[model samples]
Target: MIHLVQIIQRFVRIPTGILAIMIYTLIVYLIYLAFTKYIPMLIHQTFDMIQSVIDFYEHQPKDADPVLQYIHNYIERNDFFEQLQNGASIALGYLQDIGKMAVAFAMSFILSFFFMIEKQKTILFSRLFLKSEFSWFFQDLYYFADKFVNTFGLVLEAQFIIALLNTLLTTIALAAFGFHQLLSLAIMIFILSLIPVAGVIISCIPLSFIAYSQGGIRDVVYILMTILVVHLIESYVLNPKLMSSKTDLPIFYTFVVLLVSERFFGVWGLIVGIPIFTFFLDVLKVKKIPNHSPREIDIL
Candidate 1:
């Protein structure tokens, strides 16, 4: 044990310790910079969407006036008055969800700050605090933490890039369809992209309802078809291709995990489920647990 301790100390001596500290500091600084630049952008995009929706309704032609006769005619022909009421309800719910999401995301960023800072201390303390027989186990735990961070970051970066691209494409499609409140739709897409699997569908509901109210059911169907095609491309082709470039998990596994998480946690589950699963898997590897993919779960 003394010889092993001596070897460990010799390997990780002052210079190596200094290098680790420098690397950790660099990472924390980069994270801070990223958070600073993006948080305001996200907030701006959200408010812009809400404002656009409000303005669209505010400026709608007043009823029964000849100059606005076309809108009244369309609205009556499609019986969109009732639909508009329903849409208002949906929009209100979406707005509330957006507010909640903003709060949750802010909290996550704050939590991550503490987690990142305490990580090195946790590593050191584990070694010092563990029994000699369990010292190697603690070292394995630290190594797993590093690997999980690397994996999680890589997945998040790649997924977010795909999400941004999809948002851009979808916004263009909405404009092509002549949908009002284009910016709002785009922002919704961007926010939904953070969620896995069902995010797109959930985000689409309010936008599609608004589209239906303004245009008609047929127009809504067309928009839905377009969005579905985009989602197909995203789920089957883009997601797998991007994820494969980084990790080897099968597409079925991702789908199954998303389903289970959604069943359990609703929207929140969809956002955090896979990351949590991966983190647990990494920990299981550290602890030498037998593992199964999400597919094998028997909900019955």
Candidate 2:
């Protein structure tokens, strides 16, 4: 058996490895394309909301506005109209950025497909460089690949379901509390949740501010608390219980990975960071990379 393994290893080379990498990259790009379908509409609605805010402030009833002197004063001092215009511009820019990424992702996916097909000969030849004993490695590797893809798809499906649930709950909560533009805000939150850490902070900030402006301090506090509790349950309870039924990570490292990814890679990093980290960690375990402690694997 050991001798057989040795022959297999010798045959492995760059072509096979590159092919594998390209395939994996194509899969990721496809996922990104799927995400893009929803983002543009969400962005359009968000921009519309900004326009509405601007109009609301601009057309304040002149006489009544004087009566509500506090509101008038605050709006004036804040330059709410100008802020609204700027907000609209920023929102539009964000939408365009998403469009650009979507296009790029599509192009990359196409390129990878062609590259894999054209390099078939090269891919076969590259495998010849591997250590002779490792021929069986590819068989073991492909077995794990099949299993990993299945498990990963399930995890993504679960997270999507939970995110949708959160969106529904938040929208209902906002509507029940009489938030005027609940639909737009709810949609934004739904889209943002897929982004991970930065998404959490970004979506929450707008929600909190909307609650403050449209309702009051009490409403804002209530909204914040509700979201906080929901997130806690989602992160601490639902994730471990449902998503990571077999294994889980410590909460501390989850936060650390989130923070590090958010800081370094912005929104995309935040969304994908944990999954990538887990993948590498798993690979380390498989390869028995020296001095690397094996982490308990989790589906994120």
Candidate 3:
């Protein structure tokens, strides 16, 4: 471990501007590939899966489940092909939003590059204005901003680790079950798992639906149990261990904050709520308060 650390330190001491540029270029190329290839292929596979489901229902015996019968009747009445076309169109719209995101990423990269190259000048300029009559106010503001940004970054890092683990576990399980489109499903789960408490529930829907389409209730039940076990591990083990030391919030309280924030603020609330709550808790010194004596508690 000491040798490894020394090696890493030696590598870190090397000049990295060219390396950063190469990495950035590679990331841009990968994003382009996702847009031009992977996404379209995923869409095609999804449509194929839908078609397979339709074909399966078409050949089913008269003694099929009432729910499946109703679905077949509805698809027949509405024209499954037309519905598929509409769904595809909607998906294409979502893809356009990805293009917009790519543009934003490019802009951010450029801005960050400029900032990195001129970091000293940027600091000097900020200090010129900040170290003034209202220096105390600006200093306090900067401290708060720094703390908040650090906390937020740490939280995102922890969440990303959780998402990666979840995706890996999900991919292995899906493969064991002989599920098709394992790559796409794993990618989807990883993305969704970036959201807090409700992300698992959202990811389960498509997984369960696909399982049901493939092998009916038995497969769905198996997938559900797998999801339950994984979710339990994530909630009870990974989340507490990763976040507790950083946020100083109990797992139960963190969950409560997530639920309440989502209820009031919608989907984005799930992403930002816990970090914001933790930031406030830190700023307010909530955790630092000592336990009160019985007399003090009674007075309060």
What's the TM-score of each model vs. the native? 0.51, 0.56, 0.73
Model 2 per-residue lDDT tens digits across residues 1-300: 112223444685445445446556767777777568655665676667676655655666665534345766798998877886797798778778788887997787667555444555544554563334775776566546644543444445556666787788778888888876565787677877765444566777888766755655778788888788768877787676656642255667767887887788765666666665565565656422122111111111
What is the lDDT of every predicted structure here?
0.64, 0.62, 0.72
Name the candidate, 2 or 3, with the larger lDDT value.
3
Q: Give the C-alpha miss distance for residue 49 in model 2, angstroms.
A: 2.3
lDDT by residue for model 3 (45-83), tens: 766777776778678768888877787798789898788
Candidate that scores best on lDDT: 3
Worst 10 residues of 1 by lDDT: 291-300
CA lDDT, candidate 3, residue 2: 19
- Model 1 lDDT tens row, 1-300: 112223455777643344445555676688787579865676676566656655654466555345245654676688865786797898888779889987997787566545444645654555574446776676667556555654565566657777887888888888887775565567678878877666777767877766755566766787788778888888778877776544345668767888898899876677667766766666666323222222111111
Clashes of each: 0, 20, 0
Worst 10 residues of 2 by lDDT: 291-300
Per-residue error (Å), model 2, residue 105: 7.3
